[model samples]
Target: MSAAPFGFFGKIIEIDLTGGDARVLPLDTALVADYLGGRGLATRLFYDAVDPQCDPLGPDNVVVIAASPLIGTTAPTSARGHMVFKSPLTGVIGTSNSGGGWGHTFKSAGYDALVIKGKADSPVWIDIAPGKIEVLPAHHLWGQDIHATNDELTSGFEAGSRPRALCIGPGGENLVLYAVVGNDKNRVYGRCGGGAVWGSKNLKAIRVQGKEKIQIHDKERYQSGYDQALYLLRQAPVTKRLMRELGTAGLVELINVINMLPHRNFQDCTHRPEDLERMSGETIAKTILEKAAGCYLCPIGCQRHTRIDGDDGSTQRGEGPEYETVVLMGPDCGIYDLAAITTANYRCNELGIDTISFGGTVACAMELGERGLLGAEKEGGLDLRFGAAAELEKLAVDTAHRRGAGALLAEGSYRLAERCGRADLSMTVKKLELPAYDPRASFTQALGYMTSPSGACHLRGGYAVSLAFFGGTKEIPRFSLLQSPIAIRNMQNTGILQDSLGVCRFTGYAFGSDPWSRMLTGVTGMDFSVFRLEEIENRVASLERLFNVEAGATAADDALPPRFAETPIVVAGEEKMVSEQAQERMRRDYYSVRGWDSEGRPTRALLEDLAIAPRAGRAS
Candidate 1:
């Protein structure tokens, strides 16, 4: 805790809009090492500064943008950034990960993180330069759409020197619970009501332009480690194909093989699986691609820049819908048009909306229609039936604008369903909608969704690697219901290790590779054995779970949607049911692995083992 600079830029910026004050604070390495930066660091700060029960869509909310140690360094796939805030949707800790140059740029801007609190008297924008910070009035920018705001900011600034900007649009200004902060026009720190936080703050944009360079502990070793990672990724089929072929969208076809392509919500996953093959990135390249795109320091180039011929003869050009957005907004909502799906994808990012939540909301409305709850009388007289592309597009626009019933839909799928008395129709974890992964088919993902920190999210620990990609399915290990619990608990611990390290979960496809650990060693010059790294990951995951428990989350919140647990999913003419008996066994196993009681809460002994000993202090 000395004043000497170390691995970090050795600084964090705290901004207070209510009092219009700003200050730089020294970095605490203890916090960095324990919390591990990015999501973990932001969560630690949140726990220390804000009350657990604070309303997420209020001026008192704290939003922190954090970067990891590997960011802006010679690490592969280090383009990830995080936006953390108390969630308006879940009323608990929420953080969203995004891929772009924002994180690195923010670090370069002379700070490792920005903790924003309070509200401006009027709409305003934050401008950060090499050595200047300004809070300018944004009256003219108010009510402008996301694209327009990006356009104005880019044009208003000097050419070829526009700072990276993260801003909320009308959706956020309206405090929509699913609102997000759109970055680079098409990329977003999407999910967990970030836009609503922006709205509550009377803030329009955060513009960062830093000329400072990141200092690594050992440049030679870092470069060597990075070269090894780059070499391995280039030779690896999964990484290369994902970059060259379809990007992450390539998983669309792979997951479909195991009946994991969610179609029409969790009610049914059965679909024309072959149709996925025709829509690969290779196919998109031939059909409608304009070019490929990537973020800063990223050689993988997994982002696709595409142009599709719209029905009106105009064309839509931007980052095409990735796998999760494509499925969640396309097949999950029962819409199938590729061009339409891409357009909707662009619209979601442009409107500062979370596609997963928005699509889940629309799907719930569609299901409600089947039950005679939503129709002309409700839903602003829009017939929210499944597979209606034009209607779906209209709904997307409406929700973005918060027009008519779109206002309610913009509250997210969970809240929308609750309003209609069909909450069970909405497949969600906490208040977040289920992502593209269907756990009924992949038991690993099922357990992940049920136990994730930020609702039903797959990225927490995408078990598809072990389950469908690698040896996870070799024998389909027939575990008696008695053994299923122990197996799932083991997987959860392994997954926690990866997330805590802030590495791409794809590295799990080659687990023994230890890509993240090697990068950590290279960057920090701290030799860490694989076993020690796994222990750190386990402890980090356990810490996050404890944070949730202290905030009142319980085993009751750990259960899946009634539909997912009670109903049978008939996929490809095969009936697959996630029985309650099976789920109970798995939950028990997960609890045991973390050394918790039958309930999912962390055990006192387990916390001590993780070195997060109980003390008279806040959860952080």
Candidate 2:
């Protein structure tokens, strides 16, 4: 009802796909003040609009995409978009972020967020611009891969007004549990099952183009933070040269150096030095890398644009085979062929599957086959051996299509292992497959994974390994029990702020919340001091915990698989594993620091203190 704030349009587009109806709603300024934006704001809106216990793929499931106030600004890496939904894979809160031009363009379309509810009778795509919105029939777009869908939807627009599309490929249409949403051709909301949610609703894509400008209230203050951030980013070795030179896969050797690299479904962290080099960032850069790219306004330029020569002498061009894709699909499965991993990476992107989850699931299947758990008949004659490089790309195609052995792989590692009667073999926390990092080496990282709202996400789970490798002054002891709890808590909160602000996680390597505080205050003309930002981070984290708890999550759910405890990996000449005693103690300490009760539920008093309304029958 009132005018929007300086940094925001204070508008939300609500779409009811069942009826093909859309309405523009005024976003409450007070809510924006409390939640900030992006992940924080989307989470608040989603928690209130949908039932926590609703089936994830059912019509009742809701999807919320919000852009931060900084999105349309000049801040580095300010083009990220945050999406939240109930995860079909993990069956809990599904939160994911992506870096690309889509977020900035969506914000520039004169709205702050988009919310979709109910299910469409057929496939459709939403077209948005200033003062115009329509749900168009997308029957022709339904079965297309991500690149085709993107090109088809974004075509016909004028040069400067070409729309940016966020869409799902065949993986999503088939409802592969870990399907990802692709934007800017390759950038993806890669974690959780957001693409599956889009599929369930019969939504193909949402294309947006606009030229709306954001208002900056204090240019001097904003410039001050901007200058400091750039200076610090230039000074940090990770952001300054390492990312620009080698990209994220550069971490392969470094992570291996710390004994944190996973191998053979996390059987061990051992790898031959040559094998490591074969899949490292240096290999990608030297062998297949066509060029390095960056997202909107990003300086780190971690995006890897590469090409690989096919056996038939055909050269295929695509992006990535980043650290996670390389290790998880390579040595973790006992295959270190860069060409194989890169080819698989391209297939996963085109099909809209999550490389991390797919790799982990394949490794699980390999272990199952090695132990005689996989039925020979059901495998369709595909070898499920640990080093089956031939099956790597084939499995990706099958999984996306839910065909043959991939039907089992499509269910993710947890379900595949459980169906095979060996749930313990699944290396996951909360059913979401763990990232490339082996938690046995870092106690703080292990704690972060345990407490992360959306299952075992390194980004959502604090990215504690970053501190281990590049924290500089902010780094903490990786194995300290006393420091692990609060340390991980702070790291998770920092992640919350970055996601909420729509910034890059790599930016944290350069500076903390102070610079961002100044920029936010300058843009919104509001008091966003470090203390207030911390309060907002705590509130958002507590709110997410509330949603999970109401969805039947418990302290028990915040745990790693049995392998993390029983199987110890040697680190620094000593066997290391997260013991049960250590896990319980750290979990308890984390809850205390987060102001949650012992059972991992937020107390009603604490919720009230943070201004989060308690759901009915919760926070008792």
Best-performing candidate as measured by lDDT: 2
- Candidate 2, lDDT over the whole model: 0.91
Model 1 agreement with the true structure over 551-617: per-residue lDDT tens digits: 7888888878888777777545667666776778777777876677887877887877877644326
lDDT of 1 at 539: 66
List candidate 1 segments past 4 Å from native: 155-162, 273-282, 375-379, 465-513, 527-529, 571-574, 613-620
What's the C-alpha lDDT at position 381 in model 1?
A: 57
Q: Give the distance in Å from residue 336's predicted Cα in candidate 2 to where it truly belongs.
A: 0.4
Top candidate on TM-score is: 2
Displacement of residue 245 (Cα, Å) in model 2 is 0.6
lDDT of 2 at 399: 91
Candidate 2, which segments miss by more than 4 Å at Cα?
376-383, 467-475, 615-620
